[model samples]
Target: MDLPTTLAEKIAALSDGPGCYIYKDAAGIEIYVGKAKNLRRRVASYFQARDGHPAKTLRLVQETVDLQVIATDSEVEALLLENVLIKELQPRFNIKLKDDKTYPLLAITREAFPRVFCTRDRDQPEVDFFGPFGSAKELYRAYHFLMRVFRFRVCDLDLREDDPGRRSFKPCLNFHIKRCSAPCTTRVSQADYGEDIRALRAFIGGRNKGTVVSSLRERMKRAAGELRFEDAARCRDQIQAIDRLKERGRLRDYDEPAAPTIDIHAGMERLQAHLGLAAPPRVIEGFDIAHLQGTHVVASLVQFVSGVPNKDAYRRFKIRGEAGDGDPGNDDFAAMR
Candidate 1:
């Protein structure tokens, strides 16, 4: 089949980047909206030899008189844009997401001490949604994970800053269990809660992971300097959680199979051989230290017996030596020692 000159030229000029593409008919009505990590290759596939193409795909190609592309910084952005466009345009080819219920979004309500939850309702006013995630299971998994990390309020209580009852209201079990920050009470101010929401937004929007982690570390250091050990610990925990989330995302991206179970005795023999030890080491110990700018320095020691961790032998120590009179310095080696 001969290609239209204009279509061919547009395809030739397409950027080799992540983006969403829209296919339109003669009437300039959008028939399809699709996302691609490589816009050029993906869009070109539609115009290739049509012999093996599906009936629906062939129809889509035949009817596509014109097309448009919107490039994005990354594939995640492209996916998000594709979802929004599909919902707004109701493109004929986007059958999978024609109904909003097909994919769920994580929404953050726009209010004092905003609420974060998973929903299929995109039309909710004053709400910002993060995703049309791959599946309900994945969406809920992320939702729960984020809730655990952020500790935003899960309750539907209409919390207001000026409400007289807010200060007197009793916090729920979520607060006691450290699941919710208890914004319903006066403990968490609107401004402080807003910061948490903003951080959550940046995280879910796929912003630079390093930047978020760096910001949290700085907060941890500041809190530690102010002698707010609890606040510093919270920041430290959030940073660790973000690191775990990033690692999880990387594993998911690779879609790699789980590693086979380790052979404890064989592994111990190999380790002993590698180290040229006199015997296959029956006991091994590892030490690591955590600190916020040298303040609140803590070290953990884990023991392994025959290549398996011995949970009962684990110990945690507070590095009192590093906590000098008024000033502290990051001396990880000393703390470990």
Candidate 2:
């Protein structure tokens, strides 16, 4: 079928609601993707005789060679489909929130001990995820809090029960504070700690954070009543730890959303705006070296103007110093300066 000649005609023909829409340029390349609560009302506004349209929308309407709509049963379904199309087409006018952040989620392995740790990817088939939390700092804070309350192995050591030879290895630091069940050396039997892990994951992911801590507190009281002082003490300490962080407002019952960003400078313009320097530094070339103990040293630098790093002006420099060398200096004042 032939395309509509005028925006008015196309918008008038659109159905009432719940769908995804695409705006294409004359070349038939998709430039925009959008969703509508009321397709006819929304799309018609674009061609409503200019006064109702902003210059941006006007330009879009003027250049839009054709428009298309896919009807859906619900707004949420339209939203889902809109996301699908936008990702597949990578349309120019669509706002893409591109943030590739490697944040932490408490993962429980399918292993005998059911280890826990901070991980970013959702690839672990054995365990469920609790978050793409705000920051590593936040995750570490929660991690320490959890460590004080519960025991789980978080090391990267390849210690397995089937292999008895690894059992002779030195104890991990986590053993001292009771942070880890120490699967590496079999300090705690896998079956016992496995139960701890299941409860821990549930408590963290539970709708009410108090439920887990409350249950622990009850058990602690029961142990004390039963004349089991050591077990009572352990449970008491865990309750206190949970209470402390809860007071500090760091014990999150629900996870925070992930926010990720990458810094890119097309030129000094953006960098200048970023630094807020009275003026973009002259020849604002920054260089740094990356290496491990006198190995693999490389440097990167950027130029800035009007408070921006001009990417077209970016330069990469190779480092001549050893790892942990010239740049950091390990000198206090020098470090700050």
Candidate 3:
């Protein structure tokens, strides 16, 4: 199936990088939105084979007359951007998530002390919904994990900052167990609780993630310095949880078949041919840099042997030089060098 000349040119010029792609119909309406780790390869795959693709995919390709791509710094960013676009655009070929009964959403209630919980009821008012997550179980797990870290209220109590009744109200077991800050009992101030809620929102929304992690690290260090071992431990655990969240965004459990096993030697031969190498390359190394709002920049390198990750060969480096000074001092090119 040959693509239109213009579309083919666009495909040829696509970056071999992580991004989201949008397929537009003849009327210039978006019909489908998808993410890919390699923009060129993934987009090209759609045009290359029509034999094994589902009927819906074939139809999507047929209707698509234009293409658009938004590149991201990483694959995780691409995944998050794809989710936001799918929700906002409601593309024709994308799965419908408007039915509240079908998928679960993580809602943060609009109250003095906002309650974070998972719900299938989208009709609820005065709430911010994070997802129509692919799995209710995974959503619930994330909800629990977030509660553990943020310690936001999960109760139905009408908490007001100046509510006199809160002074006398007994806190629940969650407060005693340190799972909640007991905003209902006025044990935690509205301002501090609000800050936690804001951090939670930013973390889930995948914005300022580096800042969040860095803030947690500082809190952990301060707690340790003050001999507050429990607080320090809690902060440490929160940091680890945030790292896991970064690694697996939203826990999207797709009901797709498992990927077939790779043939290492065949893959190596293909890789050699593709790169015009004299012999099949056995080792490949990849590098990425991370920083907190351009400070504390660090780089990581990972090795792949025979098309498989060699975790033992992974290394991390603390970037040094004049680039690490001043506010917002991140220099990707200098760091790479």
Find the candidate with the highest lDDT and give its number.
3
lDDT of 2 by residue, 1-337 (tens): 2335665577778888667789999899888877776799888766667767677777676778888888764443344356457657877765432134464565667776565666777786867665554456555555655665676765434446676844554454456656655565645456545646755765564233467677777877887898877657766776776565423432242232232111111123344678886743445456554555544445566654333234666666545334535554333233323
Model 1 steric clash pairs: none
Candidate 1, residue 182: Cα displacement in angstroms equals: 1.6
Each candidate's TM vs. the true structure? 0.48, 0.39, 0.51
Tell how far residue 62 is off in model 2, in angstroms: 28
lDDT at residue 30 of model 1 (Cα atoms):
95
Worst 10 residues of 1 by lDDT: 254-263
Error of 2 at 252 (Å): 13
1-337 per-residue lDDT for model 3 (tens digits): 6677888899999998877899998889998988887899999999886888999889988888899998765555565567678888898787665444668787889898898866777889999987776557655555555666678766555679999977766665556655677787656679757867887887666446688778878877887898877667766877776676544533342211223312233456767999999998877899998889887888899886555455668899888755555433477877887
> Which ranges of candidate 1 are over 4 A from the true structure?
1-102, 164-168, 246-337
Question: Candidate 2 — which residues are off by over 4 angstroms?
Answer: 1-103, 157-170, 184-187, 218-231, 250-337
TM-score, candidate number 3? 0.51
- Candidate 3's displacement at residue 241, Å, is 2.6
Candidate 2: C-alpha RMSD to true structure equals 18.3
In model 3, state the lDDT of residue 30. Answer: 90
lDDT score, residue 337, model 2? 38
lDDT-sorted candidate list, best first? 3, 1, 2
For all candidates in order, the CA lDDT equals 0.71, 0.58, 0.72
